[model samples]
Target: METVAITPLDTAAGAEQSHDPLRRQQAVVALGRRAVAAPDSEILLHDAAALIADMVGTDRFLVAESDPNGGQLTLQLVTRQRYGGNKPLVHHVALDGAQSLAGYVLQVGHPVAAEHLAADRRFQDRFLSRHGIQSALAVPLCLPHRSFGALAACSSHERIFDAGDLLFAETVAHVVTTAVARCRVEQALATERRLSAGMLQTVGAIVLVLDARGQIVHINEACQRLTGFSLDEIRRRPVWDVLPVAEELDLFKSIFDGLRHGLGPVQFESCLLTKHSERRRVAWTYNTVCDAQGEIESILATGIDITEQQKRQQPEETPDANTPAGNPPSEPEERNRQHPNAADSRKVPVRRPSPINVERRSRPRRSYPYRQSIAPVQDGELPDPAEFYQVQCNDIAAGGFSFLSPRPPESASIVVALGTPPSLTYLHAQIAHVTRMRKEGKWVYLVGCSYTGRAFY
Candidate 1:
């Protein structure tokens, strides 16, 4: 089990006396080329250690890594072949002032040279004598803001390491440092990206990320489950082509436009046409992510698939079968309510209704409770009043209701007047569902709306 390095340390300790500047310059040039072409850290460090030992001459050459937590250097690569690569325990010891010179290089963040190790005040005389080392040179491995470790060479003879030796060693260290730093940064960034992607998938909600151009940048696993499309299937596609139906396209576009223009964070509910040709309702919370330039970079939307929740809340409110909201139905009415269908086929499946039997605020609550008026309603309550046409009524509930309109509302927002004339109760709602009726006849649009909790009573 004798493991050995490819390069062996020269035992001719006296050879350091003939340090050649030209040979050192050639070594530096070779190292510069190696730094650029070296595929990884281990290769770069090995070449650096070998070239230094060969060009400048060393009885011992090695690289040590900085351990910030332990405040020490951990010797990594060594050229001393005396015990082969399997040389155990002793060389791996932590260096303090009493043990070795690696600490001084790390602290000083520069190269150090000692012509006579025993005579140098900075190193212990007894320790140098015990290790049989007389002269040495060490160079710190430094970064832009911090020092990581050092590379060093030792000779058993005094005056063996000169100015030429120190300069050559530093050049080698420079090449190694730059390459190592780059690799370390790349490794850290790669790890961070993996963690980010994992966290994105960990979220249980449907996450849709749209770039500035309204392209689908990303969609999480929940989105795939709801829409029957994978990330690969929908990525980089236009949001309109992937998610929304034609009727919902323009509304989504306008909302995206406002969000890109600093609409801030908002919460709304809308329908998503899935890949299976099915509609799923989602309640979304949207916000924008901006770049360093303060321009809109992407829109982030997190939503929950509430189609089942809406379905459950629907049958609870049946037309004509139930009494008023917040009232208990009699036995006969309760039976009819369970059926969820009236005698008229048109009103049978219209649980998602528009403003049905809503009165104007001008009248009392009792005056307009069951008065089904065919009138045009206005969002009189807003700066830009939107005209809402009353459609044929169906059942009404506290959560949502359905109606038959002559045409679909331009936007999800609509106003239902509870009373008449000057004192009108305008209730705001968001269109949650829409179904097309057969043929182009009057009251051919079947619409369902959810209460938005905003009203002028």
Candidate 2:
């Protein structure tokens, strides 16, 4: 192996071309392959530095990267020949500047050479004096978007760097620029893939990705929780085998048939068997995943567990005639009071209708005065109501209340304000019933709502 020259190229004009052209071509070819084979930006930079040092006949090399905002140049790699030895010593350096030799090359967007750095007036930096450098060559690593940085080779002896030396350094810089660009693109693509996977895993609903053959390619955490099966155990299994349906088979069959014919997106309800042999009802919406050629490649299924919701909608059993339902009235006369100013009617002989009517009337009711407001409760935050409606509150109890309005509210659930005005308490209530009635030739809506939890009041 021919040792690189430490003497300045200015003094030895033909030193760079002294080697056979064929040998130089072979070396360049080898260096290009090595630069491309490196896996990441750091490795590529280290290899490029070593190759440039060997080709240029110098043991000292430095690779600096420019900051994206054009504020500074970061020295990423540094290599120096050991004293009295041919083997190079390499270490990372944190030196950075906007007015250094490397920075000048980057700023000028061209190659730069200095025969005597101590006396060079174009740029001033303490690096050359501290490192005992007398001669240096630098070339910018240019890319389409911006210049990445500069590649530099330095010498301890005072000797000039020629055009051939600078040209060779430029060639190496080109290779490094290409490698850096490739690594950045690959890293960006990897980040995108990670983000996509994380979003799927973190979603709240049960999500499944199925191949055209109906095999379960992927399932999210919610799916695993719903089926009581681990991803490792259920992956690559047929969807029908993994998620057996106990009822509504026709609904699922139709969904599957539509997916086969590319008829989705379709939604339906069906029961799914869990790993522990328990069945859960779910409402699912499915769509097709297509490839670049527009052909259906896979199916994506998203579903919500409706088992609890369905149970909540079921009607409660009727209480027997002898059984007392709900809490007794705080006072007997308070049951049908209807208004705050009404006189006590407990002593009056009221006509008793039926046992059912007596049980229904037992619920206590309190008059809610005017200007009471209601809004929807969301995530512990109260948003302004789109429109406020004055209600004639019929009565209120610990468990529920009824109010009269001209029309029903948009949502079935709302946050109701109770107690006296200005120092009121809010409670979340769900609409339990709605009745249409006519009073004095005017249409009226009797809205009944039940408190969801303990009353805030």
Candidate 3:
């Protein structure tokens, strides 16, 4: 039997040659080598089928793969010369276990060779007649310890594919099985790496990585925008050197201590020194990012700017009127009255009522409580001590009245005129509740004096 590699035949001749034995085994080995050397499975399938077709003088080839569970075979690639043109047609058939040569190969592990399928009775001929195929060859593509389906070649002519063709087809089939398995593994690994990178890029919060010496090692896009500094410039720069010296040293110490003690996600407020020469108060959450061996590789931090928040929480200071322009002022009038002096007593003396009048006023009488009233305070003006008014009284509690004053006075001294307002004004009076006024808008300062021999209301 002549080898297909050296057989002499017409270019268009095709007839069943199943009984013809293999003559050029070396040529079939070369085809298997080419399939393995191809970069991917698709190329391996295409070249493997083409090589066998050339040696057998056949025109159609179908490469199939076995299912992972060993229950079925899948037709992966099919090649044919359509309309006898120079361009060949390739079809990717779907995997089906019902109506194809791949399905038959999966059920029967041996090869199938048919010469004139329309008359052959050993195999199902109806499927071959439907596809206009007259002769066919199906060889199993097997790997070590696994079956990877079969290679099926057919011809439109009455006869083709001999023993030598099936041998070459089986060799290429084995190589395609190995190539497909390897490609699937590499692709899965590449997909996992891409997904990991995508997750890191979209992580929430401003991620900043700093080295042990307080130098920036890495920063995400959010951190870069917040600090107004390019990552390149901030990298390897100390954190404290960037901030102002006025801040407390305890804040920096706490940050480093928390990181060193294996504490997770420490939170604290501090000032962030910006590239534009501005200091921004910020609250930071930090954690130590460690390597696979549990050693700290860098410090990971998240920061929130709180300068405006701190300013809003502070209270305003009270102003003074005694100071000249550009100089710090002295205390106000209310504060000055808290101190005592001899001249204050020489200004106003205590007031006393007659004993006979006090006895008559104290006589029992059923009547409504006497309504005491306070005077209104002058706007933007402090009251003079000399303007205080009084009436003679024995029941001092009922004599208590209200007076209007803005911002309660710091202190009050009750002076008694022993005889009369103009003549005995130089006498001194007993002191009363110093500052019992409610502190609010233009309110009254209520002062009650202790007049020992005074009359009742």
Candidate 4:
């Protein structure tokens, strides 16, 4: 019997040809572990390339990822053996011509093995001949949903890749594809979270996110500024605790209850108690956040501060009662006469003046007869005092004056008085309150008025 010696090339060929199931299984398991251990897609691709180069006995390995639109392939990871050592390279390339091995694998959605890349007329690529790559194997990183890219192993030696190499490359590609898909989903979720955070912080209105129990989960920068409480201070605390208004808390709870019952968004005005104990009026709109199963997960509250706006809109005081009689009414008086309902009815509280105070008021009493025009609520227009019925002036004050009329004046009625002793003057007044009393066996109405603006003199 003659004993034959095996050369290094023969040993290499024998290793490639061997049908060792355990060795193949171990290699597949190692690649799967590497995929799992990698933190991101780029790192995963780099590790996968190095693993393929070592296991397939190739001098170079490359991972080319296709663009999402499928028109291009970018070289994401490349591991090549050099004289000094094996160094990894990364770059991007556009796949235009259909003859490249990576392009062919991606287009056909299958694996391709070339024993001689330069000689293969099916695919003409000068890069292969220039880089001394004689043999190569490429498999598409295909998943059920979409194809990501292609993985290829190339050798400088001739006829290095075979059917066994193709199968091994395909297995590794499948493992890497799953890992890449996971990383992509994670990256998308992370990006969405960042965008949401940025919007919450930059939006003009105060924003607060609360759990089902009304505990604050998140508060934006606007909310912090409006409430004067930092997010760290209020987080996990009940939203009502910061509000500090018992009446508003009850209203807020009712609104949240409505949300739990699947009601539409609730909008209302309330006051927010600041850290310094100052009360600031705010208008808020609340919406509910639901989970997949339609359960209430969180509540989103957006609010705007209206304190300064309300202050700027307060009614101006009437001019001094001694204003001359001939002048026109002030601007606010004119405006109130034009649009009586412009003042917010919800904010203005009506109070009845004491009968004793009206009778014995400290202000001077004028019994002299004065003709005045009374604007009818129906048309909001004031007819001339001479055409309408005449009324007696009872008393006067710097802020307002009282008059006697046969009937009770309508609420929000505009009174314009032109008198002589008070000097020529026109007054714009609103009927603030009315008192009825019996005087000289006749039912007379005492009309208490407040000057809404400066009396024109």
Candidate 5:
């Protein structure tokens, strides 16, 4: 609990007047700055101990970190001075038990002042005598909320440490603690980041990370495999520049705007274009990566390419008038016996509606509310067949709704909502084609609609 006082040294003589203590303090501060700025941890610990030893004019300094199992303190970073006639102090320590100064410091939270090292009854003096050590100081290097290690400073002079010296030593101890803590945090973060990146790359899903300006910061290996683009080609490029899908670009833009407005998480899906110049359909969920102040820093995007899955469910094959029916027509006599007055009685054998058509006409369109209350409606209005049916909806963009009118005429009108009520609606959609589901017992025909209607939002 001892506080170190800062003793201002007179710099009147400039460089010549600078002592080891002053130079060492400068080194300590410099190391602290480096620790703060360092992108990695290993150098931080090594530099911090060296700086501490230099500042205190110590023959040697050893930084020992406590083992996770609480067994003993292990020497992490060590510093020894170069003497004129003697060998440099060894940096190694044998710390299998509570015997060394480092071990004692870890065991007792209080700083150890080995001022009377030679004659102390409880202390062994051989190590001190061998190194000509008359004085030693060990301060526990404790993190803000965790106790881990100690900083030991040793000298060859007896009773050399004073209140001022103790204060300075403790300050140096704090510096070491800060550096060590920062390094530990950085290592942990790096590990977590690596694991996360690995998961995104290997989990069989397309993942992407975009920066503030909507450029690709990172895309996982899976994304590359799915899209056929190299990392170098995509980096810092606008997402749409690579995959030019206006719908997807707009979706990404909305998500970015939501995050910027402090929305926590947003999810949507749209048609995507890939690096191979192939069109893809995908579902994406985005989470905003925030800074310490809860401001948006970057975007974390996780997605799955469902283009194939969707294609399989809804094939491009359209139902044509000349296409054969699921059930073949019986022989001429059998057909007449079943329906004597059928339309085919004419010499020209007028075309007859297929059984699929008869069944479809019988099933009335159920106008039940489609997720009315809890979910948003398309463009907040119903589809009008005449003018332009605008499917206005902000919700359910991932899987859009399709009109299930069994017999879709060639030019039926359709509408889709494009924005909030009183907002402009996407209109003038043309019916592309009518495709029937081939799966057994599924009889609804999908009227493919295109937005001849311009983009409103």
Candidate 6:
């Protein structure tokens, strides 16, 4: 290996700068401003290259970088800026130290200043010889962890490169390295954000990210489907607006406001009234997001829709024998005041019991436990039972009904069975709308259909 001059490029370069270092100092400041204002590395590189060229009084500047891995022995001279006699005739070449001047700088991992290449044993690049570059100054753009690349200035005529020139080159290289580090961090953060958003959308639960003030910041796809409201429709709105039923609003407000005061990661079962004014029960896990100083920044709330699960667990109430034969069953004076997680019915209530939220639907609806077999109607007649598939019926009303299925039904109009085996009520209905939701770690669609009144199944 030939003996090449090496400079450590200590942090302080002001005292060692050429006759006037003010211009170089100003250049560093200007480059930094541009770096903050515009993060495009190429634009920063170009602007920086121009500034460095002006500082050293040379128009020949080239930036060379290796592959992303930087494990390769060769550096690729990707950019060349020429303002005079010779434009870089060759785009790139091998970085075997002797192949090109830029390549040698990267390998040395130090700044190099060669006043004369012909007599200099440091590097004998055919590129420098071919282009008649007699004077050169090279500096490595290095990060704390790894080597980035090198910046080089070449001259066709004889010129003496002194310590002052070396200082200027290193100063600019430092700025470039800092900018590169910043850009890398920003790119990594952006990638992480995209990955987080994708995961949220894919999860089988509702995810709500809220600000410190209990206002909505973001909501995932599961939330949108369950509430029938989109992010744009809910953003910056108080969490209570679309979430809590009117009766539970006061309790919800107390729990949420206390969250920011280091209270805790709370757990509760809450009722949500959807955009269609339908009620859904969700079991939630709420946690606080804190900053470095231990102050709450935001909150993350994840909930699983337990509507059907709760319904399946609750036993149907049978009418009392004491009631009059023709009279409707009377409402119970009180409900079991106990938490669902509690093993005994005598356990304490989770919260104060509020008046039950009134049903919003115009007509009363009933929940059916059994799956209903639905098949397309042909010529106003029910299809064969062999061609039918069962879908879980959610609730049924006088005019329409909703059901859960893995996918949408094949036809717009289909015959549906509403009751148990022998006394099943079969009717024809038209699909009205569809919504997507997650249940039990799987995706399912909720299809709403209206009675077509064409014929009975």
Give the TM-score of each candidate. Answer: 0.40, 0.40, 0.34, 0.41, 0.35, 0.39
What TM-score number comes out for model 2?
0.40
Write the residue-wise lDDT of candidate 3 on 1-457 in tens digits: 1112223233443323422345335555666566556455545555555555555666565566655677554453333543222323333333353356655555566667776777765445344466577777776655566665666676777775556666656665556667766666666565445434433654765666677666777777876776788878877876555442344343455456646645444554455766676777665666665644566656766666656665755421111111111111133342234222212321111111123323322213222122222221233133354554543222222222222332322223333333332434222222222112224542233333322122111
Cα lDDT tens digits for candidate 6, 163-215: 87788778888888888778877766764574465445448988988888889
Candidate 1 segments whose C-alpha is farther than 4 A from its true place: 1-18, 68-70, 76-99, 125-130, 203-457
Q: Across residues 1-457, which tens digit of lDDT does each residue of candidate 5 receive? A: 1112222222434323334466646755776676667534334444444444445555555556676555555553232524222222433444432356666665566677777667655455355456666677778877545766776666666645656556666776776677667767775686458447644553777777776666888888888887899889889997757764753454455446655655434444455777666787666656666544565556776777766676555333222111011122225453333334332111111111233324212112222223211111133344333444322121121112234443322223333543444643443332333333333454444433322223333
Residue lDDT tens for model 1, 1-457: 2243544435464354326566567768877876777456755765576567665666565666666554666664343564445342234445464456777666666788877777777755343356666777888778768665776676667756667777788888888898888877876676456436634754898888877887888887778889999988988888878887667666567667656645445455567998999988776666666643677756777778778877655322222221222322335443343333322111212233224354312212221124333232232234233333445556565344456655544444455554455655554444544554533543255555443333443
Q: Over 4 Å off in model 3, which ranges? A: 1-23, 64-98, 119-128, 142-149, 160-162, 193-457
Candidate 3 to truth, TM:
0.34
- Assess each prediction's global lDDT (C-alpha) against the native: 0.58, 0.60, 0.47, 0.61, 0.50, 0.61
For candidate 5, the per-residue lDDT at 396 reads 20
Between prediction 1 and prediction 5, which has the larger lDDT? 1
Where in model 4 is the C-alpha error above 4 Å?
Answer: 1-19, 67-71, 76-85, 88-91, 97-99, 194-457
lDDT, candidate 5, residue 434? 39
Tell me the alpha-carbon RMSD of every candidate: 20.8, 20.6, 31.9, 22.8, 21.4, 18.4
For model 2 the local lDDT of residue 154 reads 69
Per lDDT, what order, best first? 4, 6, 2, 1, 5, 3
As for TM-score, the candidate ahead, 2 or 4, is 4
Clashes (N, CA, C under 3 Å) per candidate: 20, 3, 17, 9, 18, 0
Model 5: how far is 280 from its true place, Å? 35
